[model samples]
Target: MSYVITQTCCNDASCVAVCPVNCIHPSPDEPEFATAEMLHIDPKTCIDCGACADACPVEAILPDDKLDPSQMRFAEINAAWYEDHPAPEGWKPLVPTPAPPRDRGTLRVAIVGAGPAACYAAQELLERSEVEVEMFDRLPTPFGLVRAGVAPDHPGTKAVTESFEWSFRREEFALHLATEVGRDITHAELLEHHHAVIYATGASSDRRLGVAGEDLPGSHAATEFVAWYNGHPDYADRTFDLSGERAVIVGNGNVALDVARILTMDVDELARTDIADHALTALRKSNIREVVLLGRRGPAQAAYSNPEFLALGDLTGVDVVVDDADLELDPVSARAVEEDAATALRVRLASEYAGRPVRPGHRRIVFRYLAAPSELLGDDHVTGVR
Candidate 1:
């Protein structure tokens, strides 16, 4: 009855902290967690206590016998990790950290931004029985990126906010929504009210490529597109030129993959999710059939994780395209691919995509390695990328 972590694993490591037997591998403390697509359970060591299943915010953990046919492979996938790196001997469960002595009065903590980080910080502070928490955010709603950055089609990932529910309901916790720290209230005011102020606000800005024509009307950042589709109030009215037959994304990271997937996604499939009505309406009329992702590095150094790249292959009516020549790795990268398990998997997946035969009617997500966008070719709006 050992549990298996499945495809919806969000990599938040919520399960890792709760497992009493320490069966979850590549934990947040482990070096591999940085690149691990998902956490896996060690079948031999798991006591089947069900703590991980209960702690999983996405409901991605389940008993082996209960797995649906499509998920049965994950059971084998869980065990295979042990073949290469066996579990350490005499592993003990994690012990809870002892709370600090409460010598003073109630420990009041003001957390800025009600995102996942803020919620987790509140959780830690609330553990001290004498602590009180106040969370502030500019938006009336909370959960920051989870609410505004995660793609709607993946509802499983969004379910993480459900875990944040208890943090809001705690009697010791108070929320101040629709209030900006710098404008509505000052940081000095917050400091006066609370003993300590924790700024859990995440990054909202997109980095510039500093290339020519990147500021054209048709050019936009991936963050803008993510917010627009997720119905973030800041970008609700944002629009993309999907009338074009092809769109070129300038990065190969997960967010770039997400943008490509959204561009080529079937309108009917996207309609089933909580996609913004405006974006959905626009998508219904979209003509985009190919999204060519540009990466300055070779396939071995592609920024996307394996799970996301693999999931792209499973998208209906979409083709994952990779040119064969772009896969040729230089000697340095070739050695890295051979020596690094993660790099090997990335190259192997790219090879698989390149080997696939194209389906004419399906939309394409073409991978272009060793390429950079020097200029956005257009008069005012983006017409082509150079």
Candidate 2:
């Protein structure tokens, strides 16, 4: 069976860059790519090598025969997209050129953070001879976001680390784990050893929710929760109180969905993944049954990608809920969706989700729109959200 791009495709364009035959549509270079609902694979031109599937961050691609009943429509959708949009003439596959030789003496570069951005830089640097790249991360592990930010269940997306690791295989590249820039070594000191320093220290902190009672014991930033589950050393010992029956997440982005999914997923299924042991133990005992995702704007204004929003419907035991009222778009948002393809896809999926029948499930995720929390309810701890 030919491979197809499903609803969970995050539109990250990682797949398009890797396709050898250039069968994927709405590639970053195309005019319509900005508004595309989800990427489509031309089944006729697809080699069925599964390269796109491996590149997908959310595990959204699947073989035609392997697609779930609901996802079977995507196969047709993928094929139909090609009918009007033929492959461009003279399109060639991308191949990396070998780095030219450097006649100069050894040049040293210091890269801060061992994340994807930093590793990509190292890769380019190591392509040339007489160049040495030293990568530094505060944590002991490399591939910062791949190891800590990505959800445990989406291992396919995490597979990009394999390519990052190839940079380490070069003799001129060295990784310094558990090394702090300010405390262990100063920028001035780095300049003394290396010609230049590149800081890729990934966003280390979360933007404040800035609501009253946010300082309550139960009120925690999404980053704290993500870091705890991913087993970041600084957050490894942290604990979450899942004593409440309903949990409220203040944002509607992909990270919010990831946190909500982890909370409602089957503990047994999570056990099979690489979630932190402490988080797994706490989750097994959690009483949280309802997760409310609060978005300040209408569905058309959602910051989440279509694939991430659509994936909520496919969770095994979670009933995804969206109020019809929340989906009713204003004139401005409707016009915006008309002009922007990404927003159009998000609004389309949200509308579809709102009309679906509620299924019997152990947990529920309620998406609330146009509702902003002015304050977190509680005296000593966050008991409710306003």
Candidate 3:
């Protein structure tokens, strides 16, 4: 049995560092690293050390002996990739280089918001000579939406924040918690104190779904749902109604998939993670099973990646259904979409569900296209959405 690298692998390459046998292909420095869908472990070369499994952020790596039935396909996929191209003889595993010693200088930079962008920018600046970085956030916690917006179970994506914590401890970078730019410290004030002020504040508002009944009790934006489950302090008190047997999501982006996963995932599975206490309790009572992901355009134009779509399909006890009619390619766009990786994923999704009817107790994801939502029909409490 060989270790299998599954869908949640985000190309972070943490596993590549720990693998003693160097069985994991496409290390971050490799040419194929960017294009590879996910990391693959060479079955024949693998010594089954299990170090890759420990380093995996999303628990995407599975030991040969512990392979779940759904994950067994990954072993074949991993081994097949290597069959075509053999490993180089006398290959030495690539290792990450240590950073040079920090330069001692006094340039003050103020970063607004603690999201990925801000944290990354700060890390870059701190690498320079004598830079003093001051990071501010409206929330009391420092890591921004990585802690507040990402789904709790998406530990892989969430692990990106670890780099931020390392930057914060550099002594030159100071974190100002619970500091709002406009309310607590004006932009002018920040400018006065720092040589350069970087506004890393991400988009705070959601694009409103203009259809009628969007304000109904059952209606929710993916942002709110994601934030609520991820333990955003602002949305800690908010609640969602997942009592309906079916749900309709307005977008086909990654956020839509995140919401669908949270909604359809077994309550017990989600409860074991760091998901918010309130959100977990609500999920336990959730009756929702089917989620119809309504895309305004064809599958070829979908905004999400193929891996996310594949992960949705591989989820246990959940059946993701696509609409074949919507996936029908226009002659002009077909050739272009077939070559694009992201679009190709959409094409595959369409091909997978050519003529399947949605069944009860299954989490169905409908990829609808060409139809703009004119209105959402529901009164007082949303009874039936149109």
Question: Pairing residues by index, what is the TM-score of model 3?
Answer: 0.76
Model 3: per-residue Cα lDDT over 80-174, one tens digit each: 66765565554476754555455634789999988878988897788776778999988888777778777776776777776566797888888
Shift in Å, residue 309, candidate 2: 1.5
Misplaced by over 4 Å in model 2 are 6-21, 25-40, 43-63, 68-87, 92-101, 339-341, 359-361
- Which predicted model would earn the best lDDT? 1
TM-score of each: 0.94, 0.87, 0.76
Candidate order, lDDT descending: 1, 2, 3
Model 3: pairs clashing at backbone N, Cα or C within 3 Å? 105-130
Tell me the spans in candidate 3 whose CA falls farther than 4 Å from its real position.
1-6, 9-105, 353-360
CA displacement after TM-score superposition, residue 167 of candidate 2 (Å)? 0.9
Residues 245-328 of candidate 2: C-alpha lDDT, one tens digit per residue: 999999888899999999998899999999989999999999999999998888888767666777778788888888888877
Model 1 pairs in collision: none
What are the Cα lDDT values of the candidates? 0.87, 0.84, 0.76
Which ranges of candidate 1 are over 4 A from the true structure? 47-49, 64-77
- Candidate 2: count of backbone clashes, pairs at least 3 residues apart or interchain: 1
The numbered model that scores best in TM-score is 1
lDDT of 1 by residue, 111-204 (tens): 9999888988998788777999999999999999888988888898889889888878899999999999999999999999999999999998
Candidate 2 is scored at a TM of 0.87
